[model samples]
Target chain A: MRSDLVDHVMTVFGAVVRGLVYSMLALPAILVVASSFTSSDTMSFPPTGLSLRWYKKAFDSEVFMSALWTSTYVAVLVSIIALAIGFAAAFAINRFSFRGKMFLQGLAFSPLIVPAVVLGIGLLQLFAWLDLTQTIYPLLLGHLVLAIPYVVRTVLASLSLHDQMLEQAAMNLRATPVQVIRRITLPLILPGLLSAAIFAFVTSFGNVTVSAFLTYGGNVTLPVQIFTYVNTSYDPVAAAVSTLMIIVTLAVILTVERLIGAERLA
Target chain B: MKQSVLNRRNVSVAVLLAPMVLLLTCFLVVPVLGLLRSSFLPGSEFLAGNGFSLTQYVRFFSDSYYSSVLMETFVDGLIVSVVCLVIGFPTGYSLARLSPSARRWRTMIVILPLTLSLVVVVFGWLIILGRNGLINSLFVRIGVFSSPKTLLFNRVAVTVVLVQQFLPFMILSVMSVVTQIHPVLEQAAANLRANRFATFRRVIVPLAMPGVLVGFNLVFVLSISAFITPRLIGGARVAMLGSLIYERIMSELNWPSGAAMAFVLFVSGLGFTAALNALAGSHLITKGRGNAL
Candidate 1:
């Protein structure tokens, strides 16, 4: 009984510690927004006054909004292409016995092992060779390389988790091959696909290295825009923009969870 | 019927593999090959003054500055990778054993930080670890310290942020391996009068070692190439290999020399990976760790 009591107290203490750590981790993100209200000339902590002027400046800006749109467009495209091709390859590897099975996986996974900076440099060189420098194509290609491994991993896990017996049963019932895929496999793996796509979007949306080489004067993404702007100037406007990004992201995640039931993902 | 079904499966596999093959060759293979060739090319007419030379390598190895930066980056990489595994294994195991419903919620917390971009995540850390940041503020609140703490612009800050950022990869990698170890195995061990720690130390750790190695390799490779994290968080104080390459490409515009630096980064990644693969293939780990593994 004494030992049981000790274990119980330890469990409670562990829970409290975990909560405290998580809260501390979360607080810095909140401070990014809260500090925007500071009326001081420098980025002083513990502000004395509050205002929405910085938020206003962030919204009224032309550069920030256009970059936001450009990122939005590219992220969506990356997600779609990455899922279609990555999921298909994952399905093939997991579902079939073939020569070069391990080789295919190794090939697909190597890009991720290549660091983003080196891969960025490589892409810049290749694109320059092809006379495609300073364009969205190279950036998109670089992101696609990074994204493929993730899509393959997630979709392959989901695909393998599903029982093969179902596919056999579907075929035994005279369902067409396409029908079996559409009805059984797609539904089973939809959550993984969604999660992978969402991740690809977020990753590309905030990309730096690959896009840094690829961005023309008029084609900035949110992160590149923020980095360049923040380099020369430190102000509440950058803070406001960051806060807005955080808010939008949280909203999307919660909305997606509510719509599809977040449990499906795990 | 068997023949027809086999034929159909073959066709399906080919169809599925097509796009991935093309994109991979274009983006992955071509570029790596390009990197190799570029690294070996002759220096510019200016640097070499008219001929091919081994001078790029002579410069890289001969310079203490470049060699030390490369070495520090690898050391930091090893530390970050090992730390993530140390923390991630238990967390991953807990996630795997939990009731499936509870796992969904837990996974959310695990993956949430990962979904944020590297820049955004580092930006968040900058605020907390910056001068007059949250840690210092809290320390003063409780009378732990009088002045702001020094966290950023140091080796410690780089490791902390890198560990936090890359931890999810470690967890996910280990989780994949751990989830494969059936609970029945553990239940059987319990039936034989083995204690929980004994079973885990002997049985679980051995089975989990491969995943740990994979996670280690992945994290080490990633950290070796990490630039933005070290740059932003460690400030100008860091001398990582990635920063060295950045200096050449961004500052000096010496593309050939930068290519040499990039090759060192590539070779370093490959060397670590080869060692990890050899470790995995040898199976000598089990013999050495017979007490725990």
Candidate 2:
């Protein structure tokens, strides 16, 4: 009986601690989202009145709009590039028993392990050396390096779970390897590909550390622009922009959760 | 026929591997190599000059200010790792043991912070932890203080933001590993008349050690190399390796010095990750569990 009471107490205590931690983690973004609706000019919790004035300010500002456009085009390009290369790499690693297979996998995932600051400065130096710093190519290429690891990771996860027997049977039926992959392996891994694309897009769009160094001319990515702006400004317009970003992020994440299942994200 | 088949397979594999290998090599590997190379070259002021020299590295290592920045980074990393482990382990354990629906909601709450941009999240925290921000406002309203206190731009604010940013990684790492451990082992512990605490310490912990090590390494490496949090939140008060590298390269235009500092941070981060791989092997517990962010 005494032990049963102890067990009950422990369960309740664990739940409370979990609840507190979760709330603390979610609070910052929640506050940002909440304050975006503030009727007042300044940020405050339980904001005075509901208004979208700051969001209008965000939309009307040319700087924010241009940054958003830059972020979008770059992220789209990154997703496509990362998906194409990462898929081929992942497919080879999964389907073949080649020498240096492990090495290839290591190289593919190496960018994830390297610190962003290191990559940022390294890429900046490399681009400047090649006289490519002024172009958008460095930003595109840098983001590709960052985003490809996710592509490889997600694609690999799906490939492992797919049936190899189907591909083998297709080969035995005199189907060329291309035909087999196009018909069999590709169809099986399509969900993985879509999720990987979305994952890559979000990763590129949200990246700031590397983008901070690579933003040339007026082609600042949204996150970097936001970072620069927030450092100097205290107005609620920043909060409004952040709130909109949070909504979009939540939407993408929810789609991943609904379409592919959130477990796949992990 | 066998030789033809072998050649065909080789050709196909090579074709499939080319694009990713080329991209990673040209963009990622070469740039990192360039940084390392630049650090060794002689430089007049900010420009990296021809000829091999270790002057940049020597300058960084010999300067007390720079050395302190490196020390401060590691110390903050160590503290953050310990705190995350203490808090994240229990939450992860509870998450692993929870019913499916409950776990789903809980995991979302945990992951929401991670999915948002770090800059935006830090902004939110700025309001909450700033001088006239939520905490101070509430405290004063309740007569806890006479006036609002300056809470932002300090080590405490930086640490708070770092811990919040990285806690999800720790919890998810532990949760992934915890889920893999067979529940029957815990049942057996219960069958042996062990209480919950004893069972956790004796049975669960031994099995969860791999996850703990991986989580510690990840949190430590990430926190140490973090750039934005230390810059915006730490302000000018705290000097971390990341912020120093940024200032050197961006503001000071000292590529060799910046590269040297970056390389130092890289080597330390690499050391921690290598240690993690040795202890837990290449299969990070968090792999495919979602993005590590």
What are the Cα lDDT values of the candidates? 0.75, 0.85
Instruction: Give every collision pair in model 1.
Output: none
Cα lDDT tens digits for candidate 2, A1-266: 77677778878887787877898898998888887888897776657799889989999999998998998899899999899999999989987899998899999988877889889988888888788878999899999999988899999999999889998999999998779989999899888898898888888888888899998877798889899998787778888888877887888778777766675676
lDDT of 2 by residue, B32-142 (tens): 998898888778443438788999889888988888888889889988998899889999888888888778778777877777778888888987887667898899999
- Supply every candidate's count of residue pairs whose N, Cα or C atoms clash at under 3 angstroms: 0, 4
Cα RMSD for predicted model 2: 4.4
Q: Is model 1 an incorrect, acceptable, medium or high docking prediction?
A: acceptable
lDDT of 1 by residue, A1-266 (tens): 55456546645654564454345345556677777776655454665488887878878999988888888888899989999999889989998899999999998787777777778777777887787765788878878887888788778877877788999999999999889999998887777788778767776876775666567547888877776666556666777777776765665566546545443333
Give fnat, all candidates: 0.36, 0.64
TM-score of each: 0.86, 0.94
Fnat of candidate 1 is 0.36
lDDT score at residue A216, model 1, on the 0-100 scale:
55
Off by over 4 Å in 2: A1-13, B44-48, B273-293
Q: Each prediction's DockQ?
A: 0.43, 0.65
**Candidate 1 lDDT, tens digit per residue, B43-105?**
732223344566788888999988888889999998999888877776667667778777776
